[model samples]
Target: MYLVYYSVEISNLSENKQLSCFMHLQVPQTPTVIPQELNSATSTSIAVYWAVNDGDAIDCFQVYCMEELQASKDAGALVEEYRVTVKESHCILEDLEPDRCYSVWVMAVNGTGCSLPSEKAIFKTAPAIPTINAEDCTVCWDTATVRWHTSSASAESFTLEYCRQHSPEGEGLRSFAGIKRPELKVSLEPNVNYFFYLRTVNPFGTSEQSEAALISTKGTRFHLLSDTAHPALQISSKATVIHLPEKTKFTGFPSVLGELLPARGCHYWEIIVSACRSYRIGICYEAISQSSVLGLSDTSWCMRCCPTQTSSLYRFLHTGVMSDVCVTEHPARIGILLDYSGGRLLFFNAERGLVLFSIRHKFTDAAHPAFALEKAGVLTLRTGMELPEFVKHS
Candidate 1:
């Protein structure tokens, strides 16, 4: 190897003498891995930048790129190789294939010749438009939790648009700022199909629109399995909503009952008492005694809220006993999770996200959802996504 030297001339003022010193410096070594601007990548180009940190001066840089071998299929994808030499610290490679991943590296060159290649930087060119297969998207009750993955991760943010099939276009999707995790929660129609789409945007530009995603929400679909509802109580034709008479014949007894016979598995469901003056919602076994109220039966489990009377309080009822809970609020929905094999019944205040109470019991047989309404109001079986209290989903 040949050695190159650098000389510096210095003057000693006190001694009135001039001296020169010669020093040998190493050639520009390998450059650090180039930083890629993934968000700026397009179907045909990508921008990469590097920082200068070597002790020696850099004459120029050469950026090398090649297409990555994809899984399956042969490795004969005629990838046009790129060998760009530039005096600047950055370069924008052109004529790249869309949606194709590529391996890139850079080397620094100076008077001593070129340095070793840098660590490879992997990236993919974004498509003209965002694309989604809508793999993990789900619809529950009157709300749907939508999720998807883009063909390229270059997108900085996403715009989701969704609406039920029967409604006019552009009705429900809310504004979400970041696209890091591409997820959206929106209201939908129960038992009805809906359509949705997605688009990605970055500093470069907005990508093309994603294909329309289609799904259906699980609407109120439970039926009354037992004839325990009082003859006076008005049950809806769908068997999901119930109404108590203006003057309730019984104060704490069941106003309506459902036929959900859960033999196994952790069952989950909810009921909305937004318009009710008072309600007692829970699950009960078939052998539960028919009495003044469901709570008085040893075989029944329930959470009660009496809002109409002077002393309207929230209570948990089981085994002919009552325990005081918190005062109930409007828009209050009750969610019940009964783990038969686990021998536990968990109750939640959907409006507050509070675990009001949980009961552990060895269930003897199958159980069903039960309701007791006091005064005039409607209790609708909520067959939608049980939302957290933080979400303002009407």
Candidate 2:
């Protein structure tokens, strides 16, 4: 990388020879020439070995490495360098191509300036397949990532292949080729098992297939019921994100409701709450009155988290009443569970799993997710959206 410097220079007048103190600078002596060698080489890394000269004010050294080209010239486009100030006389080069030769040069750097580059040292690493770090491979909601470490400093790029783990043979895996980054982010289906494998590629050859890493995306994706959202609220395309803009006034209510109101079985969903003064999240019947606040109606059940002047807390709200329950630390997420057949509605802190409140109601109609944001707020649908929908509230 090229560096930009902002420096102020003062010039002395040649004709005026007034006696004034002049600052002097002493540049460090350049490092002496020495034979350089490659040591302890591996498929993913190469170490450069050299000697330091005496009586030199050396601060650190910069090591530059690049893949060898057919003709002898500077590989300007592909060169990657690492700078370090450690007292050691060697540096390890990582993420290189396997079974490929790399030309490397090391130079000393001090406060004043840098020394001339040392003679080039040639090194070739062994070939080996990359292995997945199962612990580092993870999936959340809709995004999944695969992470691995390799020493192939000479590698041109990598190839990543993946597929649903349960798919049949000949279906084959999906392939993403010529990727230069070590970590890969992939979009995957929710609730599906995925198998991922990697191969290191270079001008020399491709590495063998690595052991497949397994991950599963969240099972459900919740979305707002669309038209049911209050005019004061704004929803994203998928209805997963709800935002309340500032400098706005509400004529109706300030809330939105999610679709897929089910009539039977237990359903659970999570929402991430952020940047709000007060909010309500819970379940309500499709016939619930929208003219009034959510919890003040007969068919709705929800939890309210409001920030007071001195503290932040949450409580259950319903039928013109607020539960006396007080939570000290504010929660970033909330979970709602609606069991229509069992006549149960529950709310809890999503992260700590502490039940904020639960109400048993004989709900006779379809139940939908409800939200109310009294201030500028953002709410994201976390999970739970698998249901057959047939009803919508006006």
Instruction: Please give each candidate's TM-score.
Output: 0.40, 0.43
Q: At residue 205, what lDDT does model 2 achieve?
A: 50
What stretches of model 1 exceed 4 Å from their correct place?
1-221, 248-254, 308-312, 328-331, 384-394
Q: Quick one: best lDDT, which candidate?
A: 2
How displaced is residue 181 in candidate 1, in Å? 47
Scored by TM-score, the top model is 2
lDDT of model 1 at position 309: 45
lDDT of candidate 2 over 1-394, digit per residue (tens): 1232434344565554444444433344444333433335556676666776676667787777777763555655565554445456676777875676778777787666777777776776655777776445434445566777676565667889999889987998899998888888787765677788988776545677888887656333346766888888889875678899987888867888876454655566778885666888887777777776888887777787778776676667778676756667777877776766667777766677677777877877766778888888788876633322211110
lDDT at position 299, candidate 2? 73
lDDT of 1 by residue, 169-233 (tens): 65665445565566776666555777777777665544555788766663222455437777667
**Candidate 2 wrong stretches, greater than 4 Å:** 1-220, 385-394
Error of 2 at 212 (Å): 18
